[model samples]
Target: MHQAIPYRTWIHANTRDSRDLPLAVRGAGVDSASVAKLVSENAVIVIGRRGCCMCHVIKRLLQGLGVNPPVYEVDEHHEAAVAAHLGAATVQFPAVFVGGKLFGGLERVMATHISGELVPILKDAGALWL
Candidate 1:
């Protein structure tokens, strides 16, 4: 199944290596420039406090939709900084970005999924190949 596999599997495979990131790469207020690069670079990202259950929910939903987004599990102290970098007014746990833009949190994600729009959105975001 690895052969001709969609990008979802690849994203999930890489998610396990997050623990290897050095402290500097973890946060320290998550410098705006680096945050910009992160949002611009990935098709989908889940920014939330480390070990947040809501973040896990978002990730699982995406995976169920065939999109395994790489999450940036930030520290609580840096949520505001990350939120500002993403152009949001306030910090929202499990803040999701799709196609390099803020896609809101669990509420928006679940709404989109229940409405049957998530798969197409993931496809358009290039996070889903099938």
Candidate 2:
């Protein structure tokens, strides 16, 4: 049987981990304790609408990647300014704020994911790896 879902569905019903390949491999690299400490101390704020497809997708993506950043709803009482600035002007849903910087919307997130930059970026921004 065939199933249908929203365009931005971040479904993982039958998906498996693609982590078999080396994700953090390096020929000659040194781990920095300071960076690790800094990352652990930061927080990521994800602004999104409750029913938005892209929003759901982004949320699921982050969660599946083992990162559980705090999620805020634009329609909620708090985070009004953030929602206003993101939605009123740009009509963007799922506005991700990493380290207090606007990280754009779902398209940007997809781009980052496709480009294989999301992991490191999220790591640096302290948004993921929970």
Candidate 3:
């Protein structure tokens, strides 16, 4: 026997890894503090796709940093086009933006944090640990 599933759920789950999140390749001039502030305030959107490992890692990293980010699925939202274009990315999975600026992908995010750039950014953004 076969199991049944909801159409919307199926679509969302299946499109989790679809090419729709545009990420900036040249790395935009985004300060980590700006991102931390937005995420901490839950004002910025954390664009992500379901079933994406990189996306998951980004979320975990943000959480580790004590940031509760607002998540959005680019492929599921038409307005994402504006962000994608502004981000200058090719709709890659897991695109993070803060204060209307593209903050690059997981690799960049991790690198910044490891290089001790994330803390200062988060602190300036008023989202870092006291």
How well does each candidate superpose onto the true structure, as a TM-score? 0.76, 0.54, 0.54
User: Candidates' lDDT values, in order?
Assistant: 0.72, 0.52, 0.51
Off by over 4 Å in 3: 1-44, 76-91
Candidate 3, 61: how far from true, in Å?
Answer: 0.9
Model 1, span 23-110: residue lDDT tens: 2134444667767776677788887787788987888888787776767777777777778877879757778889988888899999
What would the TM-score be for candidate 3 when compared with the true structure? 0.54
Which of 1 and 3 is the better model by TM-score? 1
lDDT of 3 by residue, 45-127 (tens): 46555455676677678778877554544344433453444446474557676545566777778899899897677666554
Q: What is candidate 1's local distance difference test score?
A: 0.72
- Descending-lDDT candidate ranking: 1, 2, 3
lDDT of 3: 0.51
User: Model 1, clash count?
Assistant: 0
